[model samples]
Target: MQKKVNLASAGISAEESQLFRESITGAKPIAQDKIPPVVAPRKLKRRTDVLAKALDDNLFYFSDEFEGYIAEGVSLSWTKSGDDPHLTGRLRRGEFQPQVILDLHGMTTREAKAELAGLLAYCAKQHINCACVVHGKGLGILAKKVPNWLIQHPNVRAFHTAPKTWGKHGALLLLLSVED
Candidate 1:
């Protein structure tokens, strides 16, 4: 019992009505005009627990027996045993530019350890070979501890106290072994 409607009465001209009909001549009727809903993919979360566990087990232990003595105003430099001896020299010469810099100013030993682990993890993930760590020269606490912590990490191939332009005694240029 639908009421009959006229195109002319609806204000459509005959030429326009004819053109519309011609345009849709081969079209089939749609049973449903509703669009389907889209579902977004889930994002993956990083496993900080595993990373923390590894850091705790490997990086936190600093042996008092192992003496890494550094006199005030002296630049620090070290290279892993069996690595190229020239690597330390190259680091000292400032051949490698730091891709990232970590400032550990005013951070406690615990906080610095956590931040250092995070930075190393990030550098490994990003395949960064060079990094600068600024531990400042206030009390020389971090200045001493930073080297000990770095020596523990296997990724650290070599490290040299930054050049005069780069923080000198207050910062270190690290050469990391990044897996390709």
Candidate 2:
């Protein structure tokens, strides 16, 4: 002899049963077309300043911005001297240097540029002089933009495409300028 389970003890009451039946069987839902949706079309946010400077319809190419960047050079004198032994300096320090690496995967030119600016700002704030940006293999996207952008940035002293183990073709070892 087995005992039957009482559903009422499970907290499902008669009122809930009545409500469910009324909602499913007695209710006639209004047509979707009869209801007006509450929403407006959104406007696109664009940067007029960037558009004005970018001669090409596209903003990522090596344009005058890059050319001008190459013309001017990193002026701040940075030495391999700093209290933080972990931070990479202007010159190669002994093994204690930290690998300051930035990853820019899945970023548009505008976003990447902004991020690069942020990194520069970070380096400036932290007094970090050297860092690496891992861009990922020639995913064939954001390719030229990374190098050219760094080339023109005010704080960048020099940058070279990284060799294999670090990130191969996808990374750049950047030498940043130190502040006075």
Best model number under TM-score: 1
Candidate 1, TM-score vs. the true structure? 0.65
Clashes of 2: 0
lDDT of 2 by residue, 47-120 (tens): 88885554232333334345332213222112223433333232333222325778888887677766676777
Error of 2 at 159 (Å): 0.7
Off by over 4 Å in 1: 1-73
Clashes of each: 0, 0
State model 2's lDDT: 0.59
Candidate 2: RMSD over Cα atoms?
Answer: 16.8
Model 2 pairs whose backbones collide: none
